[model samples]
Target: MQFSKSLMLLATLATGTFAHPAVGRRQATATSAAVSSDWTATPSSGAYSTAGFGSSTSSSGTGVTYEGNVGNPYGSNIIQISSSDASQYKYVAQFTGANTDSWTVAIFNKYGSDGKMDGWYGQACLTFTLAAGETKYVAFDDDSQGGWAAASGSTIPTDSNGGYASTWGEFDFGSTTNNGWSGFDVSAIAAQNADMTVSGMEICDALGGTCSSISPDAATVNNAYTSAETDVGGIGGNIASGPVRLAVTIDYSG
Candidate 1:
């Protein structure tokens, strides 16, 4: 289902403004750490693999595109990671030719027993067009949280759509009570034969401190995304159902 820009526009009228989610107040002090790495590959029939992670199937869509037949098609299309270690890094995944229907960019995290997202971090989503052989970069930030919150007035459709427009929004994974997370969940159902290819993926440590970057410690991305998806909702929207590929990225601070 296409996003109701009118609805979004109406909501905008309330405050007449759109904004990014607010971050936690506690400013864990630190310096800027660089996280420049790549993990780009086509899934082997719905299976995702990284340097140190397990394999999971997509149920429907493999690699980039999918028929979106099965129920909950976007169940497990992420690189899993284990725990948080000192060497934790950043991760990112880009998509090219994504000028079709709707698309989503999300980051999922599995919290450890300690009540915090063990190795979890943050994620981002962007919309762009390709220029005959040109590619675009869609990245995620593992250094922060609060990207999964829903954008104001925007409702997730339970069906499908043919196109989507560009708009700034936010998402909230349930509430603060739930250890859910925050990340981008972009939906673009615009039908325009375009080729979207994810160029790279990386993971790193947090920016302000030595805290967990992508995850709390050394956790891999595969595990991180899976853990988070367990509670993720409104995936591909109401109209568009089943099997969607969510382009993602991992940020590391080494």
Candidate 2:
């Protein structure tokens, strides 16, 4: 399957427009079916991405296309979050952080400008080109929200807007202002369900301890989410709020 685009004149108008399902109605679930390249989903099934920012939707497969923000908002090679504050953010550093080549990574926060479930996150708030071994961070506010950072390239497809689809590292931080918690999980649901490429990815704590990942080599995925496990909950990390620095390895094989 191929993906294309129809960009708007005013970039901010779309702000990576994500539609469908608000936060209160947002629920995660899945199956453990064998993965294939012909994955599809109805409106109420499988997870999909936003149609705003620099990307648009084509209503492919059964219903909607599992897309990403079309363009890189932070330009190329410009990482987001400079301080690397462990308290308000997590780092995608170390644990084989560098890739053989650059991958376009897009961040879709759990909420939109209006603070709702902006679908799969409307704005590509932090979009950039990530080089091999490069370090970057995404911040979390006091709101009861979380989101995902999707990286696509190598074997995946990039739309005309320069957005890459497939391969996602989902996260949520500072949930419950008084007693917040941070959680994370790796997922191949959107891509595998859309019959697109499912690149390997892994996420670990600051010291490369306790991990979750989608191993392309191993026949069995290690503590990660696949199309079959869409409805399956409690499949990720749940840590109390504090300093959290995650070590990420993109295109992981182990």
Candidate 3:
């Protein structure tokens, strides 16, 4: 289904202006890319499962868990996504770190930005390391296929008082870990713009070593988040000046 022009205009307005550089057609290019996508909440029954770590406090009594020394003083844990429709939209996983553990995200897309997995587009993944108890907004832009593209003229909205939003994603495994992170808002956009089929989504300790693609449904599961709002297309915030933050995640099953 196609999105309305009014909505497109609204999305453009929310991101300042759509005056992109004249270098390509109507598509997602490094110079003319839309803001990160957004999504709605999914129903309760379709949530997936997770595994890899325990919920108990870590050895340092930091109340965090460690999953195989990915760098958590607590124990270890991870969240997975392997849904069929997961490819139907773009997705971003949002997180907030508590201690000095490096955080990062990994991604594997079936279809690259222009539709090829190994094609060159733009920045496909992003990582953010937080200071002890620092709150910030970290978004993962996967539309770029040409290695790591930079997000120019884009800004992460801070709180009214200019304080960073206390949210982060993925943990320290470094960029080579193949598990880049995406924010919840960006996922909402991907779900609408492209036909991306996702096979793996995970969050683990980056320092311990590396992790493999486990099932989205694992043991010791907690709460999960998904979106039921289908037919999501085009940029979000079409009716407002600023984008609304949705701090939620969910497991998907094929």
Candidate 4:
């Protein structure tokens, strides 16, 4: 379990780019706020701490590592935020087919504006299975931006630099403190760069602002990032500030 996540990539270390997931937007608050509590630890065992990144407390109530954690920080995936607290956050769900297969998924919190674009928090990964018509919703703090990396195997592949090697479901939420604009996109640059299997993925705001997706073959893409689109920026959605509920479809086919 190598804990170093300083990803050195070919894309710009700052600003917006499809090659990496940047230029994040975050929600209704005047400024981005740190979330605290509401998460319950799972049954698995690992060194789980209750810490949050960037002046924010872990909304899930515990800090986690990418691979060594006992289980998902969000626990049951049915979050425990109070109605009052829920007002300040948006939710996203990962949908899958009706099969009982499992996948490795990890969500990393971006280190704000420190460069080293892959500013991943200590660790944030969730591995689970979804039955028919089942999905799990994960909450995102207002004015927060990060990436959710998913792969089809029990173990997620890593890049040459040991970073997650998979298509990223990048998201940015709006708040009063920030620009108050939300955005989401998909990036396959990591997987392609590692020459690994690129899983298909799609992300769309539940309210239908816009969508970003890529096919499994890595040929057909819509508003999503591909290795060929390394130099591109601002390819994903730029939604107005409000309550955002993004739906991310993994192992996408269409």
Candidate 5:
């Protein structure tokens, strides 16, 4: 993704020849915050692959690469924070492909009584088309609710309450049509919480045909923050026959 180019475009779109101080000032604040932070790639849950760019995986965990065969359902555990105190973090989901297919990504946040992993909340949903060999990055902050952006180092726009919960978050990828082969190259998470000990991380899979039945892997990621290149979709090049709900369980502590 062309971070500088996209920022220029965003500026041009936000303001014309005449600049509004109020709007410009707000934009400037957001831009500055995003630019100030350095992003670290999260480790992969499975085996690591260098076929894609933007993120890397570690040796201990495995990575899944979702490519080829359209209309299949794929999901990944994007962020999993298990801290006693409130923590702030950001998740980056990068999609890279060489096709002109439209894809839909649904973000699910685990919620319930005391952040128990009892229910799942649909936080944000996004759909976009990718040109051949195009790489696009979407980011969301746990503290800011459902803010998302296309450029890396770009501040998340605060529109909805996407605040972080004491649970797991996931990204579900699928095609809008049966066109075939949408790519999800990277699944990365970055924690900005200060003085927080890195406990564990792992790749999880949500299976079944309904939202309530979806489950996650019991393992945790061994590293602090890392990226994964895992293939999270249906088997035999076919999409799941029924409603494949992507949900997570939250277990918050007091």
Candidate 6:
């Protein structure tokens, strides 16, 4: 379905980031049921599925678990930390002598007219401060209803659309404060009929813009963040330290 003029305007105003004026139109990829999720770390040992982060070290931990199917073209990319375990695994601290003390975790999807992953169609960045031995949970999701943790003292910020809803099937990590963090819910925008290409996830400074393009044909296991770029969103207020870690999971039906 074509986006209404009002909806497009709302997106332009809400993000303050406009879509590339020259985006080419292309056919959407075929829907698939083959789903998969992967996890990665900067130092290789900072995250664990069980305890999360490092088991021996005192640094904070970060991880991504998948829920839902990408085979459903109109379905939502539901990747988030559980609200039930929000208190146990939301915000995390950086290990001493690690890259940076802060982090910006995000999920990115590419859209192009070439029927391939082109430029970023929708992206969400969750920025947080991490101190040694401190664990905090920050919730985020691609759903329109906002899949964040409200009881965790976090809430999604109101956008130009009035509430925390995704217009162009976008994703969000809520606001950059504790109060904002408490308002997270599992609401995502439906894919509708938009054509999109799934790009792998990445961890970088909280600054906006593109970081690196992960090859979708790689091993599909645990790929490290590489070919980093510094000029993502042009020095933003939400900046993170160096050496950000990101874990990504992609579920698609072949």
User: Highest TM-score, which number?
Assistant: 4
lDDT of 3 by residue, 112-199 (tens): 3233232112212332333333333322222111111111113222233331111111112111111222111122112213322221
Separately for all candidates shown, the number of backbone clashes (residues 3 or more apart, or on different chains) is 87, 23, 57, 16, 34, 46
Per-residue accuracy of model 2 over 91-164 as CA lDDT, tens digit each: 22332445577776666543334433342433555556667776555433322233344454523353333333
Instruction: Identify the leading candidate in terms of lDDT.
Output: 4
Per-candidate Cα RMSD to the true structure, in Å, reads 19.6, 15.5, 21.8, 11.2, 22.3, 19.7
Error of 4 at 114 (Å): 10
What's the lDDT of the predicted structure labeled candidate 4?
Answer: 0.50
lDDT of 5 at 178: 20
- Please list the residue runs of candidate 6 whose C-alpha ends up more than 4 Å from where it truly belongs after superposition: 1-75, 83-100, 110-116, 119-122, 125-254
| Candidates by TM-score, descending order | 4, 2, 1, 3, 5, 6
Candidate 5 per-residue lDDT, tens place, 208-248, comes to 22221111121233211222212222211122212121222
Model 3 residue 167 CA deviation in Å = 16
- Across residues 131-155, which tens digit of lDDT does each residue of candidate 1 receive? 3223333222221212221111222
Task: Please say which candidate is ahead in lDDT: 4 or 5.
Answer: 4
State the lDDT of candidate 4 residue by residue for 1-254, as single tens digits: 11111111212123232221122222124222433332222112221222221223222111121111111232222232332233234443445543345665677644312222353332453345444345555655443445667776566688776777887777655422223456677888778877988888888766765888898868789988877766565677766655566667877776
Q: How many angstroms is residue 119 displaced in model 3 relative to the true structure, after the best TM-score fit?
A: 9.2
Report the backbone clash tally of model 4: 16
Whole-model lDDT, model 3: 0.22
lDDT of 6 by residue, 91-111 (tens): 221111122233222223222
lDDT of each: 0.23, 0.44, 0.22, 0.50, 0.22, 0.22
